[model samples]
Target: MMNACPEKVIRMMDDYLDGEISPSEEKELKDYLQSCSDCRKIYQELTKTIAFVQSVSHVQAPPDFVQKTMAGLPKESQRVGVKRFMRHHPLMIAAALFVLLMSAAMMSSFSDDQQFSFTKQENLVVEGQTVVVPEGQTVIGDLTIRNGDLRVDGELEGDVTIVNGQYMASSGVINGEIEEIDQVFEWLWYTIKGTFQDAMSFFGGDDQSIEE
Candidate 1:
């Protein structure tokens, strides 16, 4: 009706019932509903459901519960001081600090220059170099690279491929194929480029040295 699909109109019912539909659409729907008996019935049912659900939310808590609970808490003059609060909640405070630090580290990782994520390889390894990936990341699918080396310290769900150099996994797992080329420089270049990129990304800029 009115060049609008039934699905779209149904989905917009929530918005329309709340009087949130734009004026143009409201007018169009109203005009269409005047001519469409099915849509009018659907609208009436939806309105009834909304009213019934809202009415069911009329509930009350036990009498004087709030007042009795407040009576048990110490008055402001007898409340624990800040020093006592810290002394009694050391573990909670430390846990909060740890969460804060972890959150900051996660945010910093987005800008790290040497940032690296495992890439999926689709082919099997024939002949290539090997390198190792460090711990903590995960790869979800098979990985194959031609003329490249890989080291695995993280987890992989796919096979691996190296065309030339070496592939070493001190830890982490690979579930797929790996293939690569056979060149020492390939590994070196990849390592160097990846390192700098990760470093920059994590640290936020290439202008500063490690000491800075």
Candidate 2:
């Protein structure tokens, strides 16, 4: 039998076998192992056991495993149904919420005594708080104004549409038809349809004119 080593040397030997010791600690453990036959034997047994465990634990997945497992599952149509349901549920809820909020806002505005005024200043078309047309004494394109009253004191070469508000033309020349939309629902529908048309025109490379 080999001579017994100290408990401290055995602990250091275990640390060295596990590669958990610093270089200096490893050197100390190596020196001790060379002098202590019992510790060296323990280290040799630990190393062999670890090597055997690693060799047996290395595993590779079979090539046909995924294919075979998927073959037993349900069709993609069933999964797509669930996915579409999940996707559209949120969109439907969001759409409903948006409609509700818009309705509330429109109702509140309708009840209020708020009045909007539009004016032509130099080359700028001032509508309420926003300035839309800049420095064009004469508008050459179709002018569509929504959610406010419109007053034109200049010349327009194209059609004019006023939604959810009144239209007043004073000394202004309109070369095309003037449309007035006062119903809230009609205005909302027209706005939404116009937006969709604009998006389609942008993506489809079409030169369709949409109401602004």
Clashes of each: 59, 1
Q: Each model's C-alpha lDDT?
A: 0.59, 0.64
How well does candidate 2 score on lDDT at residue 19? Answer: 71
Residue range 164-208, candidate 2, lDDT tens digits? 666664666668888887876776666566555554455345223
Query: Which residue runs does candidate 2 get wrong by more than 4 Å?
Result: 1-68, 71-122, 127-136, 195-212
Over 49-167, each residue of candidate 1 has an lDDT whose tens digit, in order, gives: 88899889667878998999899987765334644554677567556655565555545543432333334443322223443444676756656444356767677776665544457
lDDT of 1 at 25: 83
The best candidate by lDDT is 2
TM-score, per-candidate, Cα-based: 0.30, 0.35
Model 1 CA lDDT for position 206:
27
Candidate 2 colliding pairs: 123-135
